[model samples]
Target: MQINGKTAISYHYFQRIKESLTFAATVAALLLTQLRVALIMSLVRYFKLINIFQVLFKLFTIEFGIDSSGSALDLANENIVLNELNQGKVSFVKGDATTFMKGAISENELWDLVILDPPKLAPRKKVLQSASGMYRSLNALAMQVVKPGGLLMTCSCSGAMTQSGMFLKTIQGAASMAGRKVTVLRQAGAACDHPIDPAYPEGQYLSNYLLRVA
Candidate 1:
């Protein structure tokens, strides 16, 4: 075959075009196969076939128990508090500590025990100052509701707020605002199930303190 120069160039161009088309088709086919596999896996999981093992593992491996808060019960539990008060143990109030101290309850109406488990005041370091203000305000109000010899259980779950720093500042701020003296009774942390990994101190989120407001 006698091929001219222009004809040879045309043949080379056609070959390159064919190779490009073949590569594109291969990539498209691979993607479609992956999508089909993903769809099948999703359907299996949705139908509970793949989740059956997880369900069985949880059912057989997990054990549950009811924690008994003996004679010295948590006054926050409505049923327990009502039951105790009915049995002539102690009285209780169902209200927010912050609002309750701010004249929500009469001055004569005082509580023997108070629990301040407010929500997370600061989720990040940037909001720590604002969160501290909220904590101080709340504690100030709480101080008014507690009797002279009453017990106060104040707590915070803000990881950004250190335990010693936030707790001491809260007591100081509340005392300064309400013009009351607070005595520290005890300090505590989370229960067993919520263990704090030494490597990850952020895992320890809860800080609880028992104080006497006078």
Candidate 2:
């Protein structure tokens, strides 16, 4: 993998990928992070790179050599920041997840791999309802563009939604509504570094699921 500079992916995220994906495949990320970008680079060295919708143009510009071909969806108007940085390599779509997904689906643009690792949707119990709605909407739109029988992996940072609880159930609901079937492949929780104390059950806050979509 050709890294632009000296950015290293977290060991925790790097080792979670168990599938062997073909290089030069079309990849999309809903919520982009350094770790996810690193993983993408590692898998497909350099062939048709597409970024997620977020506030990370400069990072990807350096990593993927983003140009007109590689695009990122920035819902929170992060493109402004990228503009200020003078990073024009990436095409930043200015809209929310729903908007970007709509365009992708209408255009029949499908991806081979999809990665999702958004920020905390439900930070407090009181907002779980709203957060759940957002998650469902995001996943539903993302599902529509995933190539048939492809892979879709998402992460939930809220401890309230664990593998056996609300999170996977939420993704399942989205898949069902989108007319997509999901086969549970592997589910991951906290890394070794993040310990869950018996007294503090909420210490394990990261829930990642790798699903085979049909």
Candidate 3:
């Protein structure tokens, strides 16, 4: 999906992540924070959790959605109401995600769960190198703010990056940079609705990883 011409990970991908989210809830059972460029994907994930994880959400979940675009935050707020979720439990922040992560780090604030779903950083093969560095930096910052033994669900929607098959290596670099040890608990691609042709690897444009940070 595209929001204002910006790529948004399809809601289908969120369906693939439901198990990961539930696992995080079982472990931390505290806070859930999502940093992303698109509002719909974030809202869709939040909506998906409502029915199956209703008890956990009502009693234990406090969500924070961080995005740089104010308009995106506004749309997320609207979706919250439309979905009939308790608005008071979900907070939307309008700020650069990296900056917000940095601030959270400095303030010694931490979350039990963090989702880093950035925009498509590498649109073409030529920029894949630079985009890898961006991913490393962003994930490094995000890892620092996750509570010890917490969960971090990081995603990449860049076809170039995903097809290159260097995502795990890039995340390993991020973990080293952040001075954090991470264990991959789950790995997934876009949902079954988005079929992938093995002959055309670019068809697999989404890569999601659920990591345990310690």
Q: What is residue 209's positional error in candidate 1, in angstroms? A: 0.7
**Model 1 per-residue lDDT at 181:** 85
Best TM-score among the predictions, by candidate number: 3
Best to worst by TM-score, what's the order? 3, 2, 1
What lDDT is obtained when candidate 3 is compared to the true structure? Answer: 0.66
Indicate the worst ten consecutive residues by lDDT in candidate 2: 1-10
Which one wins by lDDT: 1 or 2? 2
* Model 3: colliding residue pairs: none
The segments of candidate 3 whose C-alpha lies over 4 angstroms from its true place after superposition are 1-56
Candidate 1 RMSD to the real structure: 30.6
The TM-score of predicted model 1 comes to 0.54
Candidate 1's C-alpha lDDT?
0.48
CA lDDT of each prediction against the hidden true structure: 0.48, 0.51, 0.66
**Models, CA RMSD each:** 30.6, 10.0, 7.3
Over 4 Å off, model 1: 1-97
Summed backbone clashes in each candidate are 0, 1, 0
